[model samples]
Target chain A: MQNKITIKNLNAWFGAKQVLHDIDIGIEKNGITAIIGPSGCGKSTFIRCLNRMHEVVPYAKASGKVLVDDRDIYDSDIDPVEIRRRIGMVFQKPNPFPTMSIRDNVVAGLKLGGLKDKKILDTMTEESLKKAALWDEVKNDLNKSGVSLSGGQQQRLCIARALAVEPEVILFDEPCSALDPISTSKIEDLMLELKEKYTIVIVTHNMQQAARVSDHTAFFLYGKLIEFGETDQIFKKPKEKSTEDYIIGRFG
Target chain B: MDRLKLSFFRSSRSKLSGDFIFEAVVGLFALGILILAFLLFRELFIESGLSRKTFGLSFLFTSTWDPVNEIFGALPFIFGTLVSSFLALLIAVPFSLGIAIYLSELAPEKLRTPLSFIIELLAAIPSVIIGLWGIFILAPFIRDYLAPPLSTYLGFLPLFQGPMYGLSMLTGGVILAIMVIPITSSVSREVIMTVPTHQREAALALGATGWETTRIAVLPYSRSGIFGAVILGFGRAIGETMAVTMVIGNSPRISESLFSPSYTMASVIANEFVEATSKLYVSSLIEIGFLLLVISVIINVAARILVWKLLKVEGGKVA
Candidate 1:
C-alpha cells in the first residue's frame, strides 16, 4: 500500500518535559493504523503531532517532519489551518457545538469556510451523517440542539461533523474510550467502513481494540516505538519482548 | 465502653441541632434581603404619595422642574439617564469584548496576569477620585479634542450639533463608559475562559483560523454570559452618582444635542436631596428615586430571564 503520511525524526515537548522522542512512522492510504500504548506513553501526543494540534496547548512544541502526499506539512510556507483542513480529528470525548442544531453542527466546518449555498449544505449534511451511521437516528430531529442526543449519538454526530469537511485523513484520539461496549463496537465498524475511502489513524490504550480493528499496529512504551508490524504479527508473534509482555497483559 | 458510646450518641444529637441552627441563621439572612427591599419600596411609595397623587402618569412625560413654584417632572432626568447609560454601553461593549478576547485568548502567558490585575485595579479606583479626574481631565479632553471633529463631520445629525461644553451629557457618558469598562471586560474574560478546550479544538480541526475559531466557537458559547456582563455595566451606569453628577452639568433640561448639559435621576437626587425644602419638592425627588429603583429591578429581571432562556435553549452543556 502507498504511504499517505510520512513522519521523520519527530519530537514533542510540553514546556520542559519531552513527551515524544525521535519517531518515524508511515501511515498507509485507505487503511486503519492503530497506535497502542499505556497511559502517559505519548500515544495521543504522537497523533496530535500529525495535524499540528499538539502545539495548540500553551508552551507545547513539536519539531521534525510531517509529510502528506510527499509534501512537507511543516514547511515554513504551509499554513497550519490548511494542513488541519486536510487532516481532520475526532477527540476522545464527543464535543458537538452546544449552541448549534444537529443540522448546523454537521455543516459547521463548511460554513466556516464560507460555503453558504443552502442546497449543497443540506446534501453534504445528509451524506456525512449517513456515512457516520447517524442519519437514520437523527433525521427527524435535525433542528434539535446537538447536545440533546444520547452520548453514543453525540459521538456519531461528532464523527459526521468531522466528515463534513471531506478531509483526506481522519485522526481518532481514543474516540471510543468514553463509550459503552455497544457504542465501541459500532465505532469499530464505522472505522472499518471509513478506511475504504480515507486514511485512518487511531490512538488507543485498548490492545484488544487494536488487534480487532487495525491492519497495522505500532506499540509505544516510554516515548519510544517498541514494535511496529502487521496486526496479526504484532499480536501473535511480537518481535520485541516488551511488546510481547504488553500484549500478553504482563505489564502495561 | 458503655460510657464512651453514650457520649458519642450525645455528641451526634448536638451536631444535628447545630446544623439546624446554622441553616436557620442563613435562611433568615436571605429573608432579610427580601424584607429590606420591600421596606425600601414601601418607604418610597408612601413618601412620594403627594407627587404621585398630584401629577399621576403625566409626571413621567412632562419636562419642567421649578423648585420655587413646586412644579416637577421626570422626563429630562429619565431621558438623560437612559441616553447616557446606552451611550456608555455603545462605547464600552466593543472595547470590553476586545480586552476580554485579548486577555483570554491572545495574550501571552506572561502578559495575562498583569493585564488582568490592572483591569481589576481600574475597577477598584474610588468613584469620587474618578469624578475629580473627570472634571480636570476627561471634560477638557472631550471639549477640545473629541467634540469638535464629531460636530464638524457629523454635524448634520442632531446628536453632534450645538456648541461643545466641557461639562455635558457627552462627558458624562464618556466618564460612565470608562467606569463601566473594567467590570464588563473582567466578567466577559471569565465567561470566555469557561469555554472548554475541546470546543476550540473542534473549530481548529475544521481548518478555522484563530479569529474564525473565536468567532464560531468561543463567542457563541459565551453569548448569554457576555450579555449578562453588559447588563451589569448598564446597572452600574444607571446608578452611578458621584462621577456622573460632577460631569453631567446637573441641568434639568432635554436637548437633541449630546453636547448640551443634562440631568440624570441619580445626579438630580444627589445634587438636590439636601437642599429640597418644600414638602412637594422633596416628594417629587423621592418619586424620581422610586422610578429609578423600579427601572433597575425590571432591567435585572429581564436580563436574568434572557440569560436563562438562552442557556436552556442550548441545553446548558458545554461539552
Candidate 2:
C-alpha cells in the first residue's frame, strides 16, 4: 500500500513527562486503518499528532518528522491551519458547531477557508452530507441547529463537516465510543464506503470493530506501537505475545 | 432476638433531614431581596407621578430646566446621559475588548493571574476617587490641549461644540469610561476564557494563525457574552452619581456641546437631594431616580433577550 502519512521517530511530551516515545508508523493511502490499545495507551495522542492538534495544551511539545504526502507537517514554514484543512479530524464526542445550522456546520471549514459564495457553499454542503450518508436525514431541516440533531446524526454531521473541506485524510478519535450500537454499525459501514475516496485512520477500543472495518490494525501498548499488520493476521495470528494476549483479552 | 435488635438499630441510623429547612431559609432570603427591590420601584413611581401634569413625555424632549418657575424638563439631562454614555462606550469597548483578548488569549501562564487581578482592582476603586482624579489632573490636560483642538475640527457637530471647559460632559464621560472599562474587560475576559478548547483546536487545526482563530472562532462564539458585558457597563454609566455629579457641572439646561455644563438623571438627583425642601420638588427628584431605574431594567432585559437568542442559534459550540 502507498504511504499517505509517515511518522519517523516521533516523540511527544506534556510538560516534563514524555508521553509518546520514539514512535514510527506509516498510514496507508485511501484505506481505513485502525489504532487499538488499552485506555491511556496514546492512541488518541498519535492521531492528534498527525493534525498537530496536540500542541494546543500548554507545555505540550512534539519532535521528529510527521510528513503528509512527502511534506514535513511540523516544519516552521508550514501553517497548522492549512495542514488541518487538508487532514480533517472528528473527535470522540459529536462536536458539531453549536451556534450554526446543520447546513452551516457542514460547510464550516470551507467558510473558515474563505469560501463565501452561496452556491458553492450549498453544493459542498450537499455533497459532504451525501458522502457521510447523512444527506437524507438532515436535508429537510438544513436550517435547524447542528446540536438539535440526534447523537448519531450529529456525529455523522461532524464527519460530513470534516469531509466538506475536501481533506485528503480523515482521522476519527474513537468516533463511535460515545454512540449507540445502531450508530456504531452505521458509522462502520460509512467508513467502508469512505475508504474508496479518502485515507481514513480510526482509534477504537472495540476489538470487534477493528476486525469489522479496518484493512490494517496497529496495536499499541504503553505509548509504543507493538504490532502493525493486516487486520485478519493481527486478530487471528499476531507476531508478538503481547499483541496476541491483548486481542484475546488475556491481559492488556 | 439479638438479630432483630441489630436490624432495628441499622434501620434507625439515617441522618435527620435538615436540608429542606435550609433550602427554605435561603429561598426566603431571596424572596425578601426581591420584595425590597419591588417596593423601592413602587415608591419611586408614586412620588415621581407629581410632576406628570407639568412635564409629560415632553419633559424628556424639552431642554429648558428652570428652577424659579418650577418648570423642569429632562431633555438636557437625557441628552447628556445618552451622549456622554455613548461616547464612553465608544472609547471603552475597543480598549476593553483589547484588554480582554490580551488577558484571555495572549498572556503567558505566569502573567495571566496577576494581570487579571490588576484589572479587577481597577473596578474596586471608588467612583469618587476616579472623579477626583478626573477633576484634578485629567480635566485640565483635556481642556487646555485635547478638547480645544478636537473642538476646533469637530465643533461643527453639536456634541463637540462650545468653549473647552475643564468641567463638562466630556470630562464626566472620560471619567465614566475609565470607571466602566474594568467591568467590561473583566467580564469579557471571563467570557472569552469559557470558550471550549475543542473550538480553539478546530480553528488552529484549520491552519488559522493565533489572531485569525481568535477573531473568527473565539470572538464570534463569545459575542453574546461580550454584549452582556457591554450592557453591564452601560448600567454602571447610567446610574453612576458621585463622579458624574462632580465633573458634569450639573447644569440642568440642555446644551449641544460636550464642552458645556450638563446634568444626568442620576447626577441631578444626587446634587439637589439635600436642598430639595418642597414635597413636590422631592417627588420630582424621586421621579428622576425612577426614570434611571426603568432605563436600566429595559437595557438589562433587552440584553438578556439578545443573549438568549444568540445562545439558541449555535449550541454554544464554535465550528
Candidate 3:
C-alpha cells in the first residue's frame, strides 16, 4: 500500500514532560488506520504532529519528520496554515461554530479562505453535507444555528465542515467518544465510505470499534507503538504479548 | 440511642433555622438596593418640582440658560452630553477592541499579565486627576497639534469648522474617551478570552490564519458581550463630570462645530448647584440631575439585557 503520511522518530513534549517517545508509523493512502490505546497514551499527539498542530499549545514542542506526500511538513519554509488546510481534524466533542448557521458552518473553511463565489460555496456545501450523511436532515434548516442540532448531528456537521475544504487527509480524534452507539455506528459506516477518497486516521479507545472498521491497527502503550499490522492479524494472531493482553481486556 | 437521635434532630432543626435567617438577611440587602433607588428618584422628583411645573415639556426643547433671569433649558446640556459621549464612543470603541484583541489573541504570554495590570491601573486613577491632566496636557496638545491639521484638512465639515479653542467639546470628548478606554478594553478582553479553545482550533483546522480565526470565531462568539462593554462605556461617558467639566469650557450654547464650547447636564449641575441662591435655580439644576439619572438607568438596563443574553447563549440554557 502506498503511504500517504510517514513519521520518523517523532518526539513531543508539554513543558518539561515528554508525552510521545520516539515513534515511527506510516498511514496508507485511501485507507482507515486506527490507533488504539489507553488514556494519555499519546495517540492524539501523534496525529496532531502529522498536521503541525502539536506546536499550537503554549510551551508544547515537538521534534520529528512528518512527511506528507514525500515532503517534510515541518520544513522551515512550509506554512502550517496550508498544511492544516490539506489535513482536516474532527475533535472528540462536536464543535460546530455556534455563531454560524448550518449551511454557513459547512462552508466556513472555504468562505474564510476568501472564497467569494456563492455558487461554488452552495454546491460545495451540498456536496460535503451529502458526503457526511447530513444533507437530507439539515437541508431545510440551513439557516438554523449549528449548535441547535443534536450532539451526533453536530459531529456530522463538523465532518461536513472539514470536507468542505476538500482535504486530502482527515483525522478523527476520538470523534465518536461523546456519541451514542447508534451515532457511533453511523460514523463508522461513514468512515468506511470516506476512505474511498480520503486518507483516514482515527484515535479511539474502543477496541471493538478499532477491530470492526479499521483495515490496519496500531496499538500504543506508554507513549510507544507496540504493534502495527493488519486488523485481522493484530486481533486474531497478535505478535506482541502486550497487544494480546490489551486486546483481551487485560491491564491497560 | 434515643438521646443520640434527639441530638441529631436538634442539630438539623438549628441548621434549617440558620439557613432561613441567611436567606432573609440577604433578601433584605437586595431589597434595600431597590428601596434606596426609589428614595433617590423620589427626592430628585420632589426637589425639581418647581422647574417641572414652570418649564413643563418645553424645557427639553428650549436652549436658553439665563441664570441671571432664572430661566433654564436643558437642550444645550442634553446636546453636549449626547454628542460628547458619542464622540467618546467613536474614538474609544476601535482602540478598546484593538487592545482587547491584542491582549487576548496576539500578545505574548509574558506580556499579558503586565499589560492587563497597566490597563487596570488606568481605570484606578481618579477622574479629578484625569481632569487636571486634561487641563494641563490634553487641552493644549489638542489646540496646538491635533486641532490645526484636522481643521485645515477636514474643515469643509460643520463639525470641524470653528476656531480651535483648547477647552471645547472636542477636548471634553477626548478626555471622556481616555477615561472610558480602560473599562471597555478590559471587559472586552475578558469576553474575548471566554471564547473556548475548541472554537479557535476548529477555525485553525479549517486553514484559517490567525486574524481569520479571530474574525470568524472569536469576534462573532463574543459579539453581544463586546457590545455590552461598549454600552457600559457609553453609560460611563454620559455620566462623566470632572474631566469633561474641566475641559468642556462650560458654555450653555449649541453649535454645529465640535470645536465649540459646550455644557453637559452633570457638569452644569456641579458648577451651579451650590452657588444658586434662588429656589427655582436650584430646582432647575436638580431637574437636570434627574434627567441624567434617568438616562443612565436606561443605558444600564440595556447593557444588562445584552450581557444577560450573552450569558444565556453561552450557557445554552435558553433559546
Candidate 4:
C-alpha cells in the first residue's frame, strides 16, 4: 500500500483555457487506480500529465509537481524520454505500428534503445506477448503486419507492445472503450493480473468498469477531484454528493 | 395496386438509363486520355520514319550528331539526361527530405506553416529566370572558385581532370536540383503527415526520443510515399527543357567530366526544332523525342514494378 505516484497542485492548460484545476492524488504501488469522470472532465488530461504527454500538443502546458517513487518527474534535469520509458502509456485505440511485423511491434521500444541482440529480442517479444495474453494467437505468424489482427487482438498486441519496455507503471487511457464486451472482459482480467507486478492507472468513462477493476477510484467532475477513496468506500459510502450522484446513474 | 406497380417500374427503368449515361460520359472522358497518348505516339513515329528506317536501332548507339551530314545519334543526349537527372536526384533527395522532416517533426507550431509555404513558393519562380541566375551567379562562382579546388585536389579522376567551363553538365544538374526541391519536399511532407497520431503515440509512449519516434515509426510507414515523391521530382528533372537548354551548352558529346558541355533530348529538341530545315534533320529530332518518350515510359513502368514488389514483400500495406 505504498504510494508510487504523488501529484501535488497540478494544473494543465491548453492555450488560454485551463483544462485541469489544482489536483492532488497518490497512486499506490502494485495496484490499479481508476479515474472516472464525465466527458471533458479532465480525467484523460490528468493521466497524460503524469507521463508529460500533455505538453506534446501545440500550446498545451502544465505546472506543479508529479513525483514517481519519491523523485520529481517534472524536474528540468529529468529527460521526458527517460520518464516515458519508465512509465509506459497504452492509448484508447489499438495503435500497433501499421508497417511493422507482430514481432517488430512488440520489440519497437527495445530497438529505440539500440538493443539489437536477436536472441534477446526474440525472447522478450515472446515473454511480453505471453504476459499480454497474445503469444498463442500471434506466435505462429510473427511476421504478419501488426494491422492484420482483429480489433480485439490488435488491442492485445498494443498491450504487449507497452509491456515490452518493462515499465514501472503502465497508463491505460480508456484502453477498452473501443473493444467489445468479450475483449473488455479479457482486458479487465488482464489488468487484475497485471496489478500484481506493476502500478496501473486507468481513465474510464465506465463507472462499472472502474468499480469492477480498481482498488482505489478517483471521481472527477468539472476539472475537480470530487472524491478519492478505496473502491468499496467510494461506491458504497462516498463522502461527496457528486460521487454518489454519478455512481448511482444520476447526472454526470 | 397495379397502377402503383406500373409507375414504380417506369421510374426505375428511367433511373437505370440515367445511371448508364453518367457512367458512359465518365468512361469516355477516361478513354480520351488513352486516345490522345496513342495519337501523339503515332505522330512522332510517322514524322521520324526517315531516321528509323535509315539507322534502325543503331541511332541509340552512335555518338555522331552532325546536322549538315544528316547523321544523328542520341547517345550524348541520353547520357546528358541520365547524368544530370541522376545528380539532381542525388542532391535534391537528401536536402528536400531534411526540409520535409523538419516541417513534419521538428518545426515549432508558429513557424511550420509559413516555412512550408515559403519552401513551396520556390516552385513558383519561372525556370527561365532560374537559368538566367545560374548563368550569371552560379556559373562564375563555380569557374572561379569551386572548380579550381576540385580540379587541383581531385585531378586524378577523369571527371575532375577536364577544363572547367562555367556552362557544363554540373551547372545544369545543380539548376535541376534547385528546380526539383519544392516538389519532393512538399510531397514528402504530405506523405509524412499521413502517419496517424496513434502510430506516433505508440512510439513516443515507449520512451523514444522525438527523432527515434519519427525515424522508426513515421519514416518507415511513409517510406514508399517519400520514394514516390523523389520519383516525381526525377520525372520533372529528366524532361525539363527551357532552363536546361539555356545552360547545358547544347553540345552533343559523351564526356567523362561534369565540367564538359553536353546535350539532352529535350534540350536538343528545344534548341534546334525551329531551325531544323532538312527532312532528315526534323526526323532525327523527332526520333530523339521518341527516345525521350521511351525512356520516361521505362522509368514509370519500373517504378510501378518496384512498388508492387514492395507491397508483396510487406504484406498488404501501401508501397
Tens digits of lDDT, candidate 2, B80-172: 788778878988999999999999898887899999999999999988898888889888988998897787788789877777778988888
**Model 3 Cα lDDT, one tens digit per residue, B58-123:** 889989999899898999999999999999999999999999999999999999989998997998
- Positional deviation of A250 in candidate 3, in angstroms? 2.5
Q: Which pairs clash in the backbone of model 3? A: none
Off by over 4 Å in 4: B1-38, B297-319
* All candidates: DockQ: 0.71, 0.41, 0.63, 0.56
lDDT, residue B21, model 1 = 62
lDDT-superior candidate, 3 or 4: 3
Model 1 TM-score, all chains together: 0.92
Ranking by DockQ: 1, 3, 4, 2
lDDT, candidates in the order shown: 0.91, 0.84, 0.92, 0.88
Instruction: Point out the higher-scoring one by lDDT: 1 or 2.
Output: 1
Worst 10 residues of 4 chain B by lDDT: B2-11
Tens digits of per-residue lDDT for model 4, B1-319: 5323523224354555655566557878888999999999999999999999988999999999998888888889999999999989999999999999999889988898999999999999999999899899988887888899989998889987788789898888989999999988998898788777777877889988888888888898888778878887888898889888878777999899989898888999998999999998999999999989878877667655544444453322443
What tens-digit string does per-residue lDDT give for candidate 1 at A22-135?
Answer: 889999999899999889999999999999999899999999999899998889999999988899999998988988999999999999888999999999999999999999
lDDT of 1 by residue, B32-106 (tens): 999999999999999999999999998999999998888899999999999999999999999999999999999
Error of 4 at A251 (Å): 3.8
Candidate 4, residue A239: CA error in Å?
A: 3.1
Q: Sort candidate 1 into its docking category.
A: medium
Worst 10 residues of 3 chain B by lDDT: B2-11
